[model samples]
Target: MRPVPKQRRGVTPRARLRVLQLPVVLWLTLVWVALWGELSAANVVFGLVVSIVVCLVFPLPTLPMDLHIRPLRLVWLVLRFLGDVVVASVEVAWITLRFWREPRNAVIEVDLETSSDFVLTVVAEMVSLVPGSLVVEARRSTHTLFLHVLDARDTAGVDKMRSQVYALERRVVRALGTETQRLPEGGTP
Candidate 1:
């Protein structure tokens, strides 16, 4: 008699964990708590069925390295994002209010240092979320950011905006990006 070998699924344990690295936090889990109220036999059955259907219909996107996250980093990222939204909203609101006579608007160019596309995107989205400025275009190949500012005084204002983009890039890296060692590292950011 010959023994048969069992089929092996290709998923590695580490890889699987990495794929689901980030937990959705209580903001999402609270949905389950909604089922707790007004529980009769029919209500409970309906709630369970609805929850299952809802989750099945609109599942979260599965990501690689999503499950392999550091909690401290996640906490910091959320806090930073919240703070950015508040500060940026306020700055944009003020910019929107002022009555400036020759609005010298200009497209600001920003060079990124990081190689990660995800980090760059986060930076761009964060910048565009503000009112006075919007990302006109981002050339990922060149790591360049073209932002249209509400107004620009001169070269200095453009330079300042560019610097802000660079700083934003660094923050995104710190938040959700992994550092990559550039080989033959000799290029401007």
Candidate 2:
């Protein structure tokens, strides 16, 4: 008779989607408010009733991942990400107009410093969502992404794209992760 092997204890494959919890909860609350309309006795009762029904009807599945969020830091990260999105949108719009005049594009590879797959996914999604740039390919093993950008002409152009990707990465890490390593006081170690 053979002895059974032990499985290591850690985040399971189905437990990584803690990120969606906040959005879903907020959505549910909004739905309840809409159903209830203005705050009144009848509406309040109805909202609670609907909220309870909604919670059971659509329970989020675990994704075997942990989102160790620092609340204040998460707030800052969200603000930073939104600000970047607005700025990126304007830049993308300008790039689009330029491409309309003279279309020249290039695919540049950006290396991701993050080790978390979840953070990488979110960062890639945000980059892809912005108009002027698209994430062409993301190789997890290499932690590099291929991005196709409109109107990229030189190394500086690619560097700009790289900077945007890293900025998004920094926000994601700050929001959803703990810094695993600290750098030296004055310079990179």
Candidate 3:
């Protein structure tokens, strides 16, 4: 008969599980608070309880996190995103005011360089948040985004839209992708 292996002392499986779940619980709690639009002791307590319950009920499969944040790059990404939003908002307003003429729109596909799901999602969300363009579909398998662009009148306009998407993807990858996912400065990966 073989001898049984001894379990480690002090750290129980339940405790290990709680450690693994902490980040998700905290993120959920923060979202809950944001949705409620208020922060109070009671709200925090309730949110924590709800988050814990949700995590326990719907346990998510743990995937290896590929995010590696670069503070300077992240700042650049935010500033550029804000600038894009402002410019896009103005352009969209102009387009809306010109009701006499129908704006030419096109659906363009952009293939992103980074393979990271997190970077892809962030880029898609940022693109969608801009007023003149919307991400109609995202293909994770191909790392591709299909965007509906306003005022894309010709092939040149469509190419511009695709390049813009590529630039956004590059910025996002620079900000939050793993080292391998990041392209060299002024060049593709």
Q: Estimate each model's TM-score.
A: 0.55, 0.60, 0.78
User: Of the pair 2 and 3, which is ahead by TM-score?
Assistant: 3
List the pairs of residues colliding in candidate 2: 14-62, 14-63, 14-64, 15-63, 15-64, 15-65, 16-63, 16-64, 16-65
Candidate 1 vs. true structure, TM-score = 0.55
Residue-wise C-alpha lDDT for candidate 2, range 76-117, written one tens digit per residue: 867766776788789777866664577578899888876666
Number of backbone collisions per candidate: 7, 9, 0
Off by over 4 Å in 3: 1-20, 30-45, 179-189
Q: What does candidate 1's lDDT look like per residue over 1-189, in tens digits?
A: 224333235746664444332244232334444546553666545655565555444544343332234567667756766786787678766766776755678987787886655666777887887556798898877767789987667888888777776655655555453663432243232
Span of ten consecutive residues with least summed lDDT in model 1: 19-28
Supply the global lDDT for candidate 1. 0.62
lDDT of 3 by residue, 1-189 (tens): 224334335657684475447888999999999999999999899999999888766655554567778899899999989999999899999999998999999998888877776778788999999888888888878788999999998999999888888887787777775644356567542
**Position 160, candidate 3: lDDT:** 87
Candidate 1 collision pairs: 18-65, 20-66, 20-67, 21-66, 21-67, 21-68, 22-66
Worst-scoring 10-residue span by lDDT in model 3: 1-10
